[model samples]
Target chain A: MDDVLRQGVEIRLTVNGRKHREVVEPRLLLADFLRQRLGLTGTHLGCEQGVCGSCTVVVDGETMRSCLLFAAQMDGSGVETIEGLADDPDRLHPVQQAFWDHHGLQCGFCTPGMVLTAKALLEENPEPSGAEIREALAGNICRCTGYVFIVDSVKAAAETMASNAPRGESP
Target chain B: MKPAAFAYCAPRTLEEAISLLDEHGYDAKLLAGGQSLVPLMNLRLARPTVLVDINRVDGLAFVESGDEVVRIGAMTRHHTVATSSEIRGASPLLSHAAGHIGYRAIRHRGTLGGSLAHADPASELPCVAVTQSATVRVTGSAGERTIRADELFLAEMTTTLAPDEIVTSVAIPRIRPDEGWGFREFVRKVGDFAVVMAAALLRVADGRVASARLGLGGAEGTPRRVTEAEQALVGSVLGAETIEKAARVAAEAVEPTSDIHGSADYRRRLVHAMTRRALQDALGRLEAGHG
Candidate 1:
């Protein structure tokens, strides 16, 4: 208790290939940190608890709920949000393109989390079956898509990422 | 909803964490994965004055194999437990129960100790631990001690752990060659808490049940090991009659309370059905010689 500060705490971390060192309130969630302070609003805030996957992001190469994490807890960690998925703004990431082509979203609130989750899945498993794909995204709730097209989108993205992969590399 | 403002400190070592806990006492809360605590804080259910973050504590996240048991660190994430080849081979029932905890995202951040400390009656890990006869290790200002899993849980969202103590790890016995394990839970949604769940560990030798351990969750106010059901299967050959009797005993042992998801009678029925299914599944695995 002696070491605690009731005011803002300074934290340094990497987000979307960029480094940020800022002072934030101890209660600030990583979701709000990204959306409000950094202006990366793609990580949607739904349910505000760990239940909804709308605020999902890649933290140290694993998908996690941003809403459950305090900004200060992410110090020195690498986080990849929805903004970091594609290099070029004109062209979408393969997963996003697959989602678009397959109509995987309707309200689109859960799309960012879904796309990032799919990327994590594909990175771990290059050629996942439909059941595996479904199991991986089971956390991401999509009220609109009914998950049929979301599954199709992830499968399509897997193929696209595999084909676009570097020579002799399976990932 | 937003959490109320609180002071935060990340301890770098277990000693420092324990000292902090001793200093702050009931005013402090440990932030492990934050999967459960942060949500409760957001809902204003638990608003501690200080948060002692244990994420930076070194040497607390590991899984080691001993000669007789598998030792899992407190900070080991659910995904690690679910994907660990060693844990899968030694305690497949624990791994299977970990998969039922939440979805992949939550699993990535949720820790084994956090779930056990939360001690929700409907949670999967506590029931699994009770069925496996695991031992929960804790450290405090007084010293380190181990408590049996069945003795750790007291009531809903409660444990025997003191406010100044932190759970350090859990040790699960390795499945013997003759042991067969099964875990089953029924959930309304993909990631919801189970309505009724059963975990069974059975050892059958020469067509007779050598030993049986049964744990039921979401059926009463506390996650419990059903000794009556275990006694029903211990001396009998796991025949249909024995399984039915154990299921009936399990159902009768629990005092379920009605909730929005199910009525008391409905959950009792589920307890009976799932007890039978879990027993049958374990026996099937035993016959297949799958450990």
Candidate 2:
């Protein structure tokens, strides 16, 4: 037990296709590791407790609450955040484009998480009904748009991606 | 909301993890999925000095089907449990119940062993374990032992596990061809904790109830089997009148406490309604010959 009380533990992992190595305190959350250490503030933190989906990020192809995970836990994992979605500022990802076209966001505090969640959903399911879109985004809370436009945005994204339009990540 | 400073060790084997727990005793908390414990730590409600992370531990995440039972590793995530074809075939009730826990993100990280060891009464896995009479297997420095799910939970957020013991896996009996099951819960939102949840299992023989098991959560400090209601269903035709009697008995038997989510009276009414609906669902399944 005495050996366990080290000041820092070294971790090596990939974030958005980039490899990183760092020594971090065990108490540092994955959310803080991304926002503070990597300067990737795209992932927002609302309720740090898992209730709010504002801190959502894709780890190894599944969406997880970054706030609930420790930085050390990402030692050998692959993480995908909102910052990794589109390679170009001029051309948004299909999901992001759909959100813009449909006016899916108002305050935009919850948009990053919402977009990533929609990306994961569309990658797995190319054709989703409005109810399915709602169910998939249930974890992501959008207090501004009342979720009607958000649902429409995800639905349109699914259609655009399914139609074989020139896409960025195939999602 | 940062957690308090704590030493961390990600053990690669079960033996190393148990030794760490044995050495640290109550000062250490096992970190499986960190769904519940991390939140408590963030709020400063639980401040453990050592975090024994067992995510890297070998051979703890699996779902193995046997001739008579299905063995699920402790570290098996809720999403795996809900989506596993083996689990869905062997115990569809467990699979269905697992799918309803929290949300997709929570399901991806939350584990079966963590949920049971946390011992939240409103949680789905605990109620399913108690209803199906699953056996939890735990290991410590001393040795290994098995505990019935009925005796595992002591109270809300409490269990019979020793400070040095770690849950390894659970064994649940496979559903028989003649058995039917139904699960129902009331929640305020899509992924909120259930206000009241009910599960019903019935075995019909010759158009009559041969055996019955009913379990309820959020009605007491621990999820428990309603023996009186179960007894009332036995030897009776599973008709509307008989099901209503059992539901009423179930509603009257439990002592529920009020919370911000619901009142005790409201939970009682939920128990009655959920029980009736669950039993009706079970009967319908049985009639459809899937039981």
Candidate 3:
């Protein structure tokens, strides 16, 4: 606890497969850390209360609300934000591609969280039914698409990922 | 929204975490999955000066079976509890109820211990724990002790746990082969907190209910068992008439508070409907010989 009261605490963690070490205040949320500190604003914060999943990101292979976590808490952990979904901008991740093909976004505010949640779901369940996809994406609310297109996108991504070779990337 | 500034410490062991709690006393709060507490903190509803993060605590996340009970470490995530085959076998009611909690991402980060310690009256885990009569294990600087699920909750979002104590694990009695259980909840949205929830477990012998346990949430300040309803089912044939009688008793027994979600009368009505449906589901499972 004494270390926390200091001006800053040193934290070492990996974001999108890249390692970084920095000194940050214990109260800095992971969402702000990514958006302000690291310049990855894709992780949008809709409701910092965790009701809206717009700030969702993968922490050690599980989806977590970045707004609900302190940057200090993620020390030594691997985090995957929406920015990490695709390697090359031209060629998007399978999930992102499916979202584009299916018109899964109108405002695009929730797309990043939606795509990451769908990616995690597909990794765990290669083939999920429409109901399962809706259930998985229930936390990530998309006010524009009405979730019909989002479900279609996730379904298509599941098929595309299953046909492709097992990627070396962690889900 | 952002939480107020707080000193944070991630202790790597249960003993170390307990000692930190002892030191901080009322000024400290335990950080588990950060699902409930974090949200409350971000909303400025709870402001603890110290956050003792127990996520890094060793040997706290596990689900193991004892001779006649299932021992689940306090830090066991809701995702694991929902999908674990072992837990499903030992306590299908718990597994079923866990699956209904929030959504996939919320479940992944939420923990059993945190849910119990938070003691949200509308939550599924607390209702299930009361129905199953589970025992929570808590540790402090003084020693360790177990509290029954029925006695653990004192009110909404409040538990009987001391400020210096941390819940370690929960032991739930295994549901026997002859016993059947059912859980039902009514929520406004897919992942919203339940408005009214009911769970029932029954053991039948000679076409009559030998033993029964019924619990309801969102109908009162704390999730509670309706012993009058349970008593009504014992030795009964569990027919529609008997089930209706028990449901009426459950509805009458609970004192629900009126809120924006629903009126007190509406909640009582929900309690009746939910109780009847839960009992029917339990009887169906028993008839199918799958309980």
Best model number under lDDT: 2
Clashing pairs in 2: none
- Rank the models by TM-score, top first: 2, 1, 3
Writing each residue's lDDT as its tens digit, candidate 1 over B1-291 gives 999888988989999998888998988999999899999998888998889999999977899998788999999999999989999877899988998878888999999999999999899999999888899999989999999998999988889999988999999999887888888888977778999999999998778999999999999877888999999899898878999999999999999978998999999999999899999899888989943
Stretches of candidate 1 off by over 4 Å are A1-5, A166-171
lDDT of 2 by residue, A1-171 (tens): 444555798999999999999999899999999999999999999998998898999999999999999998889999999999999988899999999999999999999999998998898889988888888888888788999999999998888887855666745
TM-score of chain B of each: 0.97, 0.98, 0.98
| Predicted complexes: DockQ each | 0.70, 0.69, 0.62
Ranking by DockQ: 1, 2, 3
Off by over 4 Å in 3: A1-6, A165-171
- lDDT, residue B185, candidate 3: 93
- On lDDT, the stronger of 1 and 2 is 2
Quality of candidate 3's docking, in CAPRI categories?
Answer: medium
lDDT of each: 0.91, 0.92, 0.91
Q: For candidate 1, give the docking quality class from DockQ.
A: medium
For residues B124-234, write the lDDT of model 2, one tens digit per residue.
Answer: 999989999999999999899999999999999999999989999999889887998899998888788998899889999887899999999888889999999999999
lDDT for model 2, on a 0 to 1 scale? Answer: 0.92
